[model samples]
Target: MAKRLSLLLLRVSLGGLLLVWGVNKVVNIDHSMAIAENFYFGLLAAETWLPVAGVVQMAVGLLIIAGFARRWVYPIQLLLNGVSLAAVIASVIDPWGWFLEGTNALFYPSLIIFAGSLVVMAFADQDQLALDARKAPAPVSWKARRDCGQ
Candidate 1:
């Protein structure tokens, strides 16, 4: 019971963050574009990538929070978090002094949260409160009737 609750909480927290971040990216396209220009797209100026990332984040957030299609969603979410964590970690550890001051401190908490959420999802029931939570078909053996000592 407690475990389920904790997993649910983790899902909500991470999902909410992703949803907000995605929407923010969409709503504030200028800011997103600037970030992309400076941070993401210096090498590859594929205009579609930013919007695609927003859509993916929003979809992942909704799927994870609603607990729908978790078999695929959970792994995708894990990968997304890992990538974000890696980027932040890399920026923090850059010896070239390109990283902003105190950014590492800010990212440390997010990294911890991401790792914790990954652990929770890894062991979560995945079906709780999800659309996928349906009764599975009974076994064929259960359909057979037996005669008792007739």
Candidate 2:
């Protein structure tokens, strides 16, 4: 029970952080685009596409938190964080010869969260807390059913 509680706490904290970050991107899309522009290039430049990125983040965060779509949301979150970490590394290198950008050290926290996600994926036994708890049904057995007359 205590272990389950710890897992629940981790899931809620991680999920909440993602939801907040996703919402921040959505609410301040211009800022999001600016950051994206600084970190990325080419096809990611379109202004309209920028907001869509935020929307996707928001949706994925919600799904992960709700435990409604782990199989999909978990992998997507992994890929998202992995790509973001790569972007941070690129910025740190400044390969184009421009001055290196100040590291926000965001990647470390994200990597930690990514590790947490892996934990949840590996041992969560399902979603996390109330969401999965509520979804579970009582086990059925022939003896119980026979005693209760079905």
Candidate 3:
């Protein structure tokens, strides 16, 4: 179905994005530290936060790609994306300069990812091509439910 295909594409693409971003944070801690310094990530030192946050980001991406734990994974991913988006959006003192300057690349891309995160959360159930689907049990009859308790 077109719906399934679309959801699949979104899921996979977002997963890849998260994975890469996470790895980038880990690999380039100095860069992440610099960004964090101004982006409300000042609570913790970059050396302590970036790698740990990177691991969480990588895990969220892996779970989204795996598609086996939508009930929990999707929400966590949404929270992560929402926080990141808010930070980036708030950091831009000059909104109109998003495209005019080289320093503001993340402004729009992060917006795109934030929107994608919402879309992914909204249609997480349509992911038929996921691990959860293959592992799910068959639907039970009403009679079975009644017999169990109703």
Candidate 4:
């Protein structure tokens, strides 16, 4: 019971953070684009795709919180985070002034949230408080039922 509860809490917390970040993309689009600038390249500009990205992120977050399909959703989320983290890392060639310039505060918090996502992925199997928890009824034996008179 405790394990299930802890797993649920972690899932909820991680989902909530993603939800906020996703929604923030839509609500404060310019800020989002600024952050997404790190990922921008070729035709993948934030201005052209941030809203769609926001929707996908928000949906993924909702599914995580609702525990719809932890096996699938958790992995998808990990991939998403991995891509974002890679973009951040790829963009920053040096950290000489990442702190003094005040970028660490944002980047580090994102790294922590990414860490939380990792924890959620690890415990996804123990999830109990979720839509997917509805177990199907066991197969009923017709012979046994008839012998018992309905």
Candidate maximizing lDDT = 3
Which model is ahead, 2 or 4, in terms of lDDT?
4
Q: Model 3: per-residue lDDT, tens digit, 1-150?
A: 898888888888888888987898899988777777777557444597889988888998998898868788888877877777877774344556655443464475777777888887776666788778654587999999999997
Candidate 2's clash total is 0
Q: After superposition, how far is residue 90 of candidate 2 from its true place, in Å?
A: 6.8
TM-score winner among the candidates? Answer: 3
Model 2, residue 11: distance off in Å is: 2.0
For candidate 3, the per-residue lDDT at 2 reads 93
**Collision count for each candidate, in order:** 0, 0, 0, 0
Better of 1 and 4 by TM-score: 1
Task: Quote the lDDT for 35 in model 1.
Answer: 59
| Candidate 1 local lDDT, 53-145, one digit each (tens) | 777889988887887787787787777777667656754465344655435455555577568667756666543555565655665552363
For residues 5-53, write the lDDT of model 2, one tens digit per residue. 7777876676676677677676877777777777765445566776677
Q: What lDDT does candidate 1 reach at residue 34?
A: 75
lDDT of 1: 0.67
Q: TM-score for model 4?
A: 0.69
- In order of appearance, the predictions have TM-scores of 0.70, 0.68, 0.75, 0.69
lDDT (CA) for every model shown? 0.67, 0.68, 0.77, 0.72
Q: Name every residue pair that clashes in candidate 4.
A: none
Please provide, for model 4 over 1-150, each residue's C-alpha lDDT reduced to its tens digit, 9 standing for 90 to 100: 898888888788877767887898778888887766645452334565777778888988899999897778888788877766665652243344544442333454456666778987776655667778765577779998899998
- If the candidates were sorted by their TM-score against the true structure, best first, what order would they fall in? 3, 1, 4, 2
